[model samples]
Target: MRAPAANPREPRRHHYVPRLLMKRFAVERRPGQFQIQAFDKSNDRVFATAIENIAVESDFNALERDGVRVSLEAGMGKIESAAAEPIARIVQGGTLVGMTMEDRAAIDLFCALQFARGTGMRAQFSALAEGVEARARAIVGADARLDLVGDAEGMKAAALQLIVGSLLEFTGRFNDKDLLLLQAIEGEDFLLGDNPVAMQNARQFGPYGNIGLGVPGIEIYMPISSRFSLAYWCPTLLHQMREGAALADQRLLQARAMSVVGQGVTRAAALAALPEIEALRARLRRIPDGHLAGAAVAADAGNVTRLNSLQVRWAERFVMSRDGGFDIARRMIADDSAFRQGMRPRLD
Candidate 1:
């Protein structure tokens, strides 16, 4: 008798930070692993770390210190060191904490779509969207039976719905007031205005401000997972600032705009769509299992076009109000070139 084969869809290893992070670090490949080092310019210190691809057991000790121990098992990874409490708090209920390698890839695919939009490049955005659809098709086909042509559109819809549904599921786990505050804090102009102190104070006492157990200021540092969750539901903004604006400033504006839109969607409208999200997930799960052969590749070109159209429509419909403190913040950050452009549409 032969042993069973491992799931082909599963990745051989997992990385908390993607390879892009290497851009900020000096990396050296050694035998089977990589040593990464970063120099902190402000502190004049060097930090070094190593990573490697290795088989992780379903359950195993990760780290231990001062009689405290952390473990990773069954999709859940934890750190119990008192010194690591901050890390623990930030990641406590993240979708990534317990997710398998394959699922992480799916989530990352969706994240890439968000990042692509942040790039303010139309071509990049379309490419990423098509990539996501193609990946989703491959994963779905591998796990289930389906007719590519007959169900390609349906599958694409299902994939989008699944992304949104999963995000809703995560949001649903929190209380209403907490959810509301989370949305507000994540807003682009939340901390901006004439009175920065007053704004900060307001956030400190907001509904979800003191909610994170034993984690002071947790609201200010939302988990990366939440960012992606919001990204899935929002449209990306284009960089329409006038020429001569600093590229770095434009990039920051794009990021903040993306955050605002993502957070904005979490309000009443998203809550009202909870039932629809559930239905979408249910429908996605009902698809039969089998390989769809070349269906995934066949739909790539069409999906790219569809994705671009969807993004454009979403961007057009999204309007940002200038009455709030947001106007002041935008003007403060805008370069002379951008000011002349006169408030190009807010990404959110």
Candidate 2:
């Protein structure tokens, strides 16, 4: 069933009110498949709640029909273009992008696990506005860099968006699995009745709190199927001063894996094709606009080349990660053995 209209217009520039903006709506791609999601802003959880081209009249459906904009009975309801991009394709059983192709069979199993975490975590924090504040505090701790605590205050949505921006920036280099690890950290129950360490420190490290057995107390930190996505991306943003992308834990692990296997990664093939990729990237550089139709074509081709180049860097980063390299250098590190054990990892 659809939620009754709370107000004619969605809240804007408002303080932290625990309002649930129904996220699920019917976006029919085919006859039976519809995309539905419940994005809890207060908890920062965005989960896809997909079903067949639904016929139900739920709050989400109402929200979709009547967008976040306020409706005007006496006036015209304004329509504006959406800035967000729709998912190009929803993988079967809903495999979020970036998961290893080797692990595609467990789609339903994976989503169920994610739902459990996001559901449990959001529920736990739905109340306790103070708890919400505290959670926000954890994100903006002494070591926090996204400046989430200070930037763009007063509005809950803005604060949450800033938090997302920061997370997007922070998790850039780490894999989605690492973020999943953080999600696991958020979900696990942390209390030390007698002991101070395991109860306090166990959640941060996997296996201790059980990787798949439990759900987190907070949704923002809950696990999702899109794991390890940032493990090899946005290194500069993730660690402003950390030298290389491998500074992120998961990337380091991948580097180790590459080192052990002795270079069978597709990254090598991608790197071998660098001149072609770079030439494509250079062609993209010539395009003046980021939104023109021709620009889109240029971008599509550029993105492929970039992806290939990124694959090469990722492979080298993988090797570099395996070694104890801490700097971002060139020439020496680019070489295999040096990448295997010496100075900084190369960037560019």
Candidate 3:
């Protein structure tokens, strides 16, 4: 028989969502002690705790490889460190503007890591593994000498591999979308979930939701702070915006020409149109391999609520904010049975 895997010496409290990101939505409970208000969906309870105490699982990233036990916690820490400055800048300015290419890439990887490393994702992978094992067992019948699912160590190894691989896969896909920083309107705030990266497709509905990162109309939201959120707009949506802007400009120009004949109206019209043109350009434009803070948009109360609804739906267990405000989340849970289950893979 194979020897059992040894316990890893690495950090046990592995945080899937980085503490740096969580700290943005934290309140200073005491001197140098920050606390965030969290609502646990499982128990239907709201509580206050440090950011370090939540969004974590014991040895969640630990794995056995080459007869050695290791954890990906350190590697995850490095990703958080890389993204710290850029994200902090966005929170401070309440915009996604003026980020460097490297900063953008770092944030992309970090977001992917957050999505892949969550309990929701890990549970989905586990369920998939179980389903495959069940099918394999039935196919092999009594002739099977070993468990198709392999040992715990082997499973851990596989999970670790999948998490890292997904992070890398998603980073490139996230790069394809247009980055925007969304600011919550006055008297409204964004919420953070255990699974912070809330993904949805506005163009898709019914039993077939398009969760694919590369798919058009995919909307990805991550609340960086209670006041600001990071969003990735679908390429299709950006295309539509650009097309609409062009058509509007053309119509306005034609109308001006028809109304004012044989005057130097072209120059005056162009000058007058400069501000509108710049505004549209900022909205529809992006820096090559970077992000523009000018793309920041204000989210009205309705918009903020809509985004928070995603956080509630995407969260595995808890949805939190700077304050213990969960009126929307509470209502959703009470009204919809589906919201109680949150986002999970359909094994069937």
Candidate 4:
């Protein structure tokens, strides 16, 4: 006799990084079992676990709202389903060319949600709360605050509210950027961190410099699989690819001026009136209607290494690799004192 079916509403384990994605970096252990290599930064050790085991927590996305039991797992599952096909096609084709606008929107939403929903962000929220509490205590000189501060479940609910609230705004920023496919050369693969979306400023290397999503020269890197990682380049930097950096900066100023004046006019009319603006916009559009209808150029070794390093530095916990190679991570941890200490708040 068969046992009772599992309850969809009462899922115990929920993944921050959707398993649909983890499967790309996982190895088939047996007939249906899949496993991926994991490197724990705390212990400075490497291990492997089933794909379902890592990047998951119990009731991570489940919470109560207005006295109703609500689970976001189902909604997140829908997003995973929507993105699976387009992601598979891109991985198989090994390129971003010829992708439909609908597909681009799907992937953009997936990456944005992935960026917001994670243990890393949760930890950051917790740290920020603690910082605020410390300051409050200093000013008031007393242990007087709401119970929410120390209550684990309450904190989780608050974090979820913030995550879901700002999702659309974050996705908008992602949509404004253009995709730059970073293809790994033969025998090379990208690592997937617990906090998979690595946000950085390639132009500015100062430790405390601004790397906000809307800031100029911001680069958002998300590893799609072992073979491909998507680098969303800001418009200014994308312009810099053809023109020099200085010219790209100047062009952005001009574009901003046009954008301000073109507010009242319809987009079509504005483009019709401004030939130069139309040409610049056309150059920035990479996916649809672009001539790059083939595989993207393979990234150099240095590029791959730098991308991998971002995964390490930005990660809140362990980072995973497809081939169980941890030499790069190990070397970095051994040499860098900060890494050994563990992940700290980006500002602090």
Runs in model 3 lying further than 4 Å from the true structure? 1-9, 65-67, 130-155, 205-209, 254-293
Write candidate 1's Cα lDDT for 56-96 as tens digits.
22212122334543222212211112213322222344222
**RMSD score of candidate 3 (Å):** 5.5
Ranking by TM-score: 3, 4, 2, 1
Question: What tens-digit string does per-residue lDDT give for candidate 3 at 175-241?
Answer: 8888888888889989998888888886765576578678778989988889988888787776777
TM-score of 1: 0.20
Error of 2 at 71 (Å): 16
* Model 1 ranges with Cα > 4 A deviation: 1-4, 28-34, 38-47, 50-165, 168-202, 206-208, 211-348
Model 4 worst lDDT window (10 residues): 283-292
Q: Which of the predicted structures, 1 or 4, would earn the higher lDDT when compared with the native? A: 4
Which TM-score value belongs to model 3? Answer: 0.81
Best by lDDT: 3
Instruction: Give the lDDT of residue 210 in candidate 3.
Output: 78
lDDT (Cα, tens digit) per residue for candidate 4, span 58-128: 88988755556667788878887888998898888887777888888888888888888877777777776
What are the clashing pairs of model 4?
none
User: Please, what are the lDDT tens digits per residue for candidate 2 over residues 1-348?
Assistant: 453455645532221100110111223456655444322222223344343211111221111222342222111011001101111122122223444432322322222222222112222223334354556667777354443233211233332333334433322212232111110112121110000001011234443342222222211221121111111112222233233322333444454455556466655654555555445444443322221121111224333223222222222121111111222323223554333221121111
Candidate 3 overall Cα lDDT vs. reference? 0.78
